[model samples]
Target: MTDATTRGFIGQLAQGDRQALLSEGVEQIFPARSALCAQGEIGTRVMLILRGTAKVGRTLSDGSHTVLGLCGPGDIVGEASAVAGEGSARLAAVIAVDSVTCRVLAASRFRQVLRARPEIYRTLVAVTNDRLRRTADNGVRQAAHPVACRTARMLKELAARYGRPAPQGLLIGLALSQHDLALLVGASRESVVRALSRLRTSGIITTSRRKIIIRDPDGLGRAGEHH
Candidate 1:
């Protein structure tokens, strides 16, 4: 199954298995804001998200924060830490973006499952590789491209991810606040505002409240072109 199907179907299978597993060590947690991995915690655990979102960020010198990325439902967190033992939490914190439903899989059982079903392991590797590639590509874009270009590119990517066909074209459901938009585009909130207004004036996009309607998909695509 692809990312879309894998995320959609597995949630439906063995409807009761998730609940049963939740009670036996492989439990669920709806952590409050700013939840760091517990001290002296075992590294052999997997977090399967059922809903909501979290920020994976590492602390920096001088007390500033740099977000590694945002993760949501169907994402598996704790992989890096789970893989590398005898280390402090590699990630500084996993803060709840909203209330989240998650199942914890014991590290040992996770490995056993993988050993028994090597095919799943192969798929996991492929998924991880693709994600890593995208992350590297995004970092390069942030470093090399102008914010206007990056913002346009990110909008198109998000549209493809969450968009549905509409008479107007693709309706991107990204209701990102200025700060959030800035984070993705690597721009100041003021720059985001200016770029968005300029795009609107140019007939490339239309924004209503938080929703963005792409009036000219090709134009928007060009605006976000990396090269």
Candidate 2:
């Protein structure tokens, strides 16, 4: 069994167990704006994020991009692609939102590890299911909520999942632009701008450059729950 101290999609495993998984993989670093893989591009590897943030999204017919979700440390990218067997292409593009470090595992080698450790395979299944549930939840929220509410919900989730303390309040450590927020919320840039304006006026949040500080988390949570 693995210890509880190791947190991630794969859960905590002994050092030897972790090394066993990484034995067949190579570590690499990606700078911000680097693309790990693009939708429809044939791929042969999966990446396990060791540090930093990444954005998973797809390009639309109009050439605009929609952010599906944010992937932070301990997240996996290109898992589906790797599972698609030989000659499979990506379903979405994974881009480094910030400098990222990850372990790149070849499809065959990844399967080898899973075959050697059934527990790891079971953990992967659980993680994949959880990700699906979260994606579905996000879809429902995006479809049912107003822009302001959705924006607040998104920010709240980000802050809870990846925030750090700041003098103002909780700072979402990820460098997300208004455009990125709009994409995540399925809103227009102008709509997001207006929503942010309202939040700032209400003292729920404050922004400087690309950084956002949540001054009132309780109020923000209320906004998200208001429907």
Candidate 3:
């Protein structure tokens, strides 16, 4: 799992452990906007991302989709269902945000690896716990904070995790639309647009072609604080 607070699973593994895990899988490439995995389907394999980014989300009963998290290089997807034994339904859908390369492993093989490598299993458990905690925290923040505050906090997080230094400011490497941000923040697209406009007008951030540049990180942090 990839998140602002937690490093991806492959990055956390020892070099030997990492190599061992990758050796079991076959490399596959997915194009941008492709579905890596679908929710509610039986999971047969898990994917370890080697390059690019993916978005995890679940569709609601009312036909709306909620963004769960973002996955980048070194992250693993569909592991939860793979770990849940045979015929386990996937809890979320993962789609390629950009061209993605992954090492794909069958569920049985993954389980076999876990049985042989207790250390790896422990590490996966830790990562899962961290993801769950972050999800819970986001839920609480959504209920307690204003949309603008939450949006700012999310931007700061993206910058901290995936940002690269640019001439203008810290550029978030992920290509995200206003609707994607809205889904991630659990707000209406209109509300997210207003929040982003405010950030732009105040000279805290700038956006062009789905790329966001944080001009004043400290100012963004201040804006994220509860008002």
lDDT per model vs. reference: 0.63, 0.81, 0.88
Among all candidates shown, the one with the greatest TM-score? 3
Error of 3 at 58 (Å): 1.6
Model 2: what TM-score?
0.84
Per-candidate alpha-carbon RMSD to the true structure: 4.9, 3.4, 3.0
In candidate 3, what are the lDDT values of residues 123-182, reduced to their tens digit?
Answer: 899889988987898899899999999999999988876787899999887868888888
Task: Please provide, for model 1 over 169-193, each residue's C-alpha lDDT reduced to its tens digit, 9 standing for 90 to 100.
Answer: 6776433456666776777889888
Of the pair 1 and 2, which is ahead by TM-score? Answer: 2
Clash counts per candidate, in order, are 1, 0, 0
Q: Where's the lowest-lDDT run of ten residues in candidate 2?
A: 1-10
Candidate 2, residues 190-215, lDDT tens digits: the string is 99899899999999999988789999
How would you order the candidates by TM-score, starting with the best? Answer: 3, 2, 1
**At residue 217, what lDDT does model 2 achieve?**
95
lDDT score, residue 51, model 3?
78
C-alpha RMSD between model 2 and the true structure: 3.4
TM-score of each candidate structure, all chains considered together: 0.72, 0.84, 0.89
- Candidate 2 clash pair list: none
